[model samples]
Target: MPKPIEEIQKEVVEEFSDLTDWEEKFQYLIELGEALPSYPEDKKVEEYLVPGCQSRVWLYPKEDSGNLQFLADSDTALTKGLIAILIRVFSDHKPQEIAEASLSFIDEIGLSKFLSISRRNGLNSMVNLLKNYAKNPNV
Candidate 1:
């Protein structure tokens, strides 16, 4: 089974705690970005677009046996990793679970502290998109 979000947050905090500087944090973000799967070019347009992001983003959601699954792609590497992290936390959950998760969990995971203001805003936008989808999957 996949780890719980709390466990994942703890792991990420512990794993990266040694990085004491912003430069190191930025490097780590890039490294995380490297692990994200590529988004197909065709899917990067229209309805999938995430506004307020510096990079192009596309998110597709599907329901499987009462669970929600998200497939996301971003033009910017760091943004892609950010989406990957979100997917790891939200995917495979029931729509109610996804919708009910506190957006403050981003800060609990230390993502807000390490990210730029714009990046944090972008991340919020992404989370909002997912929550909206969870609330209205047929839209």
Candidate 2:
């Protein structure tokens, strides 16, 4: 089984604790973004586009053994990293756990301070989508 989301988040926090600077955190986010797989152009449809976002977004959730796994793609580079962060924080969690995650946690991570207004809005949209996916009974 995969580690719990809280453990993953703690690991991320510990990994960056040595940096001790927001700029370094931002650089790390960018690096994470660089590692995200590119979204296929064919997948960029209205159904996948997240509302209130400046860039296109696609999120697909797969449930495995009562845990939710997310596969996401975003048009903007930073948003891809935002998705990566969300995946780190929520993926492998039970649906209830993912649904219960506090959106304010992003602010605590200093993500909002580093992201532009548009990117922040995009992040919000992404969070909503993820939460909704987690809450979906059909899954």
Candidate 3:
């Protein structure tokens, strides 16, 4: 079984807490983005494109036995890392859990304050996309 969403968020917070330097945090995000598996080219269509982002981001949702899984990619490393973080917390979980998640970890890790208004809006859009998928898988 997968860990609960709260537990996963706590883990993310713990991971971010170890990096005191902002530069270190940025590098870490880049590393996280690099760690994601290469997204399939075919899924990079308009239907999967996330809006409100400065860069291109594509998110593909798949359901397996009632659990939702997300495959995402971004043209920029930082945004890719942002989506990776969301995937880590939300993927492989039940739709209800994902739809109801608070994503307080973004605040706990100081990421929100670091983001520009546009990037923040993009992040919100990505979260909304995932939540929409959870609430209505046909989306």
Candidate 4:
């Protein structure tokens, strides 16, 4: 069974807390990005592309018995790491759970302070898109 979303978020917070500096945090993100499962090449089409992001990003959702799993990739390492975190928190869960997720971990980790305006917007867009998918999984 999957863990509760809040538990996952807290775990993420604890993980980020160990890094003392922004440089270390960034390197950790890069490492997380590098660890993401390889996204399928066939799914890298226009339909899966996430908008509002300067970097090209793709998210593919696979549903199994009402739980939604996301497979994602990005042209940039930071973006990939961001999506990887989202995937960890939101995937393998019911659509309603994902839709209603508070996602407080983003703020808890001070992730926004490190992002540029455009990147922040992109991050918001990504979150919105994930919730939107949860709201309409058939789409």
Candidate 1 — which residues are off by over 4 angstroms? 103-105
Looking at candidate 2, what is the lDDT of residue 137? 31
Q: Which stretches of candidate 3 lie over 4 Å from their true place?
A: none
Please state the error at residue 120 of candidate 1 in Å: 1.8
lDDT of 4 by residue, 1-139 (tens): 9999999999999999999998898888888989999999999999999989999999999899889999999999998989889999999999999999998999999989988888888899889989999999994
- Taking every candidate in turn, the Cα RMSD to the unseen true structure, in Å, is 2.2, 2.3, 0.9, 0.8
Ranking by TM-score: 4, 3, 1, 2
Q: For residue 56, what is the lDDT in candidate 4?
A: 94
Worst 10 residues of 3 by lDDT: 130-139
Give the alpha carbon lDDT tens digit for every residue of 52-93 in model 3.
Answer: 888899999998988998999999999999999999999999
Which segments of candidate 4 are over 4 A away from where they belong? none
**Candidate 2: how large is its RMSD?**
2.3
lDDT of 2 by residue, 1-139 (tens): 7786667777776666667787777778778877866656676677666688887778777788889977778766667777888887888889898887665556556677877888888888888888888999355
lDDT at 122 for candidate 2?
A: 84
